[model samples]
Target: MQLPGTTLLVIDDDAAIRERVANSLEESGFNVLQAGLAADGLALLGRQRPDLVLCDLQIADMSGFELLRQITELDPDMPVIVSSAAGSMGDVVEALRLGASDYLIKPADAPVIEHAVRRSLDRASLRLENQRIRERLERVNRELELHLKELKDDQAAGRQVQLNMLPASPWNSGEYRLEHRIIPSLYLSGDFVDYFRVSDTQLGFYLADVSGHGASSAFVTVLLKFMTTRLMYEQRKQDVAGPVAFKPSDVLGHINRSLIACKLGKHVTMLGGVIDEAAQTLTYSIGGHLPLPVLFAEGEARYLQGKGRPVGLFDDASYEDHTIDLPPRFSLTLCSDGVLDCLEGTTLREKEQRLPTRVAEAGGEMRRFMERLGLDPSRPMPDDISVLVLSRNPA
Candidate 1:
C-alpha cells in the first residue's frame, strides 16, 4: 500500500522512459518530481528532500555515478534506485557500491518498479530507526556512569568517618600494655572495641562483634558504642550508696536490654573486662563470644572457659563475670570469629585447638601473631577481623 505524500524523484534524460516511470509511480500513489539534467535533479533534491530517488545509471548530462554520489553527499540516508540495461550488470553493481539502493532493468514493468521502490524504502526506515535507538542507549549509559561516580565518592566520605570512630591503640604503662586493631569487610565495620581507665588501679575494656557485615551491622556497632559510653557515664553519676558500678556483667546486661528495646533485629556476641593492677586480677564477662579469650603465662596458653547468652536475643538474658589471677608474665588475647578462616585445619576442632598454641608462640606480640597467620593489613579480608591484646613484659 502507498503511504500518503510519499515523494519519489525520477531523473532520466530519455523523455519516454522518464514519462513512463513518472506515470507508473504517480498512479501507485506517489508525489512524483522529474529532472532531466544532473543540475536540475540536484536543484529539485535540495528543495524537495524527497523520500526516494530514481535515475538512469547511463545519462548524457553527467556520469550516473557522480549524480548518485552527489545525492548521497546531500542526504546519506535517502534511498536511490538506479535504472540499468540488461547487458550492464557491471554498471549495476558499480552503482550499487556507490550507494544506489536497488537496480531496475531498462524495460521495467510497473509491478517490478513499485516492488523495488517499496522494499528499499522499508529497509531505509528500519536502519534509521535502529540508529535512533542506539543514540538513545549511548545517552543513557553516560548518565548512569555519572551517577555511579557520585555514589563512590559518598562511600569514600563515609569510610573516613568510620575510621575516625576507632579508639587510639597501644595504651601503655610500665606493668601492662594494651593494643587492638580492626579490618572491615567493607567501608564500615560491625566489630567495635573500647578501653579506658575506670578507677585509679582498674582498667575497663570490651570488644563487641555484632552479627553480619556491612552498613546494617555497622549501625548496630555504633549503637553499642553509644550504649557502653552512656552506661559508664551513668555509673559515674550515680550516688556512692546506690549501686556497684564498672562491673563487666552489669555492663553487658545494660547493653542487652538497650538493644532489645530498639528493635533493630540485630544481635551481638561480646566480651567485657576490668583489669586491676593493684589486685593483680582480670574480671571479665562473656555474652556468647567465641574463639574465646586466651590467657598466656606460666609456660602455657589456653582459652578462658566461660559462656552466656548472646546480647539482643531476649528480654531476660544474663551474663556471668569470671575472674583470673594475673600470672607474673602473662598476655590476654581476644579475637572475633573472623580469625577462624586464617587457621589451616581440616575441621573446626583442629582449628580451635591450634589457637591457644599460636597465641603462646606469638608471645604477646601482635606483629608476630599476624606474620605467623599471613594476615596482611593492606589486603582486603573476607569478613570483619578484630583483635585486642593486653600483656606484661617487653620481650
Candidate 2:
C-alpha cells in the first residue's frame, strides 16, 4: 500500500511525460528512475531492481509491448504498466497479453496513477520476498549438512584414539599368558584392559569399565591408563631396585584414594592382579566387579574371591587381597557385566557358572567363548564388554 523505498522505472519518448511521472512518484515516497527510450528502460531494469515499470507505447527504438515482453522474460513476477496517447482498445489488449499489469491513457490523474503503481508494486514485493525466503532455506540446509559432517569426523577421531591406548598384543611372562578382549557399544568405549611388566618375574594387569560411553567414557579410560601405567612403573622400580615388594591390597587402596582425589562423578568397576612367576602365585583384588574370575586346574573350575568397593566411590574404603598358588597348566578368566547379558537366564551368578564349562571345553579360546555366549562382535553392544584370560603353562 505504502510505496516508501519502492523503486519505479518510467520509460517514455516524450521527455516531459517521463519527467512529470517521475516527479509525482518521487513526491509520493517512491524511488523513481527515468529513461527516454525503450532500450534505455530495459537496460536500467536489468541493472537496477525496480518494484514497478511504467512505459509509453510508442518509443524511438521499440514499442511498450516489446519492452514488457523482455521484462517478463527477465523476471516474470516484475509488474509493468503501459501508457499511450492513442488510447486504442487493440493496443491495450496487446499490452495486457504481453504481461503489462495495467494500460493507462495519456495525462491520467495523479491519484489514479498512484493507485495503479501501488497495486503493481505490492505484487512485485511479494515475489521478491518469496525469492529471498527460498534462498535462506537453501543456505540453512547447507549449514546443517556441514555440521553433520563435522560430528562424524569427531566420532572417528575418538575411536582411533581409544583404540591406540589398548595393548597391541597379548602378554606372556613364562609363568603366565594374559589375553584380553573388548567390545564397545559405540565408536568410543567405556571398557578397557591394561597389562604392564612390573619385573621379569612379576606382571600386573587390570580390566576396568567406566560409567558411560562416547567422549566422557573415553576421557575416563585415558585417565585410568595413565594412572595404572604410572603405578606399575613405580611399583616395579620400588621392588626391583629395592628390598620391598608392593602388595595388591596396598595398590588397590592407593588407586582408590587417587581416584577419589580426582573427584570425577563416575566410578570404575575393576579387577586387578599381580602375578609372581617365581612364587607361582597371583595376588588380586576386586572393586565391585561382576562375574568373579573362573580358575581352571585339574580339568575342573572354581571362583576366586576378593573384597573391595568400586574405585572413586569412597576415600577410606579398605581392600582385602586374595592369594592363589598357580597349578600347572591352570587358567583364570575375568569379564565385565556384559557377559551376563549374553546369558539367557536371569541372574549374573547363574550365567557365570556356565562360563567355566564353556572355557574348559573350548580349550581356553577367548573368542570362541564369547561366540558361545552369543555375543556378536559385529553388532553394537548395549554396554561395554571386556574379558581378560590368564593361564600358566605346565612346567
Candidate 3:
C-alpha cells in the first residue's frame, strides 16, 4: 500500500530514463520530482525533502555512490535507492554499505520498478519513525539525570545537619569520662546517643534506637534531641521537683507522655543512665532495649537488668530503676540490637550469650568490636548500631 503525503525524487543524467521513472512513480500515487544531474538532485532534495530518492550509479558528472554519501551527510536518515544497468555485485554491496536503502537494475519492468519504489518508501517511513523515537529517548535521559543530581545534593545537605546535632566527643570531668560511636547504615541513621553534665557531680547519658531506618528513623532522632535538651534546661531552672536528682525513670516517663500527647506514635527502645561520682552510684533505666548493659568490675563482666516497657507503647506505663555501685575502677557499656548479628545463634537467647565475650575483648576500642561483630558502617546494615562506653578513672 502506498502512504499519502510522500514525495519521490528521480535523478539520472539520461533525460528519457528520468521521465520514465517519474511518470511510473506519479502513476502509482506518489509526488515525483526529476533532476538531470547529482547537483540538481541535491538541490531538489533541499527544497522538497523527498521521502525517498532514486539515483543512477553512473551520472555524467558525479558517481551515484558519492552523491549518496553527500545526501546522507546533509540528512543522515534520508533513504536512497541506487540504480545501474551494470549490475556488479561489489557495486551493489558497496552502495548499500554506504547508506543506500536498496539497489535496482536499469531498463527495468513496471512491476520491478513499482515494487522497488514501494519498498524503499516503506523503509524511509520506518527510518523517520525510528529517528523520532531516538530523539525523544535522549531528551528523557537528560531530564532524569538532572533530577537525580538535585536529589543527591539535597540528601548531602540533610546528612550534614544530622551530623551537627551529635554531642562533642571525649566529654570529660572529675565525675566521669564518656565516649560514643554511631555508624549509620544509610545517609541518615535512626540511632542516637547524647551525654550532658546535669551538675558539677552528676553526668547524664542516653542511647536510643528508633523504630525503623532511613529518613523516618532520622526524623525521630531529631525529635529526641529537641525533647532531651528541653528537659535538661527545665531541670536546670528547677522547673520539676523530684525525690532523686536527675532520675532516669522520671525522664523516660516525661518523654513517653509527650510523644503520646503529640500523636507521633513512633516508638523507641532506649537505655539511659545518670552517673554520680560523689555518691559512687549509677542509676539507669531500660525501655525494651537489647544486648543489655555490661558492667566491667573486678575483672568480671555482669549484665544490668531492669523492667520497663518501650516508650510510645502506653501512656500510663511506669519504668523501674536499676542501681549498681560503681567500683573504684569500672567500665559501663551500652549497645543497640545490631550487635545481635555478630552472635552465633538460631534464637534470641543463644545470640544474647555472645555479647559478654565480645564486650570483654572490646577493651577501649569500641569500633573494632563493632567490626568484629560483622557490622559495616560504610555499607548499609540490616539495623542501626550505636554504642556508648563510660569509664571512671581510678581515684
Q: After superposition on all CA atoms, what RMSD does each candidate show versus the true structure?
A: 4.1, 5.5, 3.6
Cα lDDT for residue 221, candidate 1: 79
Q: For residues 32-136, what per-residue lDDT tens digits would candidate 3 score against the true structure?
A: 889999999999999889888889999987888899999989888788888899999999999989999888888887679889878777777787789899999
Q: How accurate is candidate 3 locally (lDDT)?
A: 0.82
Worst 10 residues of 3 by lDDT: 236-245
User: Considering lDDT, which of the candidate structures 1 and 3 is the better prediction for this target?
Assistant: 1
Give me the candidate number with maximum lDDT. 1
Clashes of each: 0, 0, 0
lDDT string for model 2 (1-395, tens) is 45366788999889987888888888888898999988888899989978888888888898667778898999788899998889999998898898988889988988889999887777777778998998998899899889978977997887788788887557776766778888888878888988767776777788888877767877788888887777666766666663236566776677778877888777888888888877878889888887788887777777787657887788778888888888878878888888778776667667877777877765666767777777776878888888888887856
TM-score of candidate 3 versus the correct structure, residues matched by position: 0.82
TM per candidate: 0.79, 0.72, 0.82
Residues 78-163 of candidate 1: C-alpha lDDT, one tens digit per residue: 99999877547788778889999998888889999999999999999999999999999989889889987886786677667666
Off by over 4 Å in 2: 1-3, 9-37, 43-48, 52-69, 72-161, 241-244, 298-302, 346-363
Candidate 1 least-lDDT 10 residues: 236-245
What lDDT, from 0 to 1, does candidate 2 have?
0.81
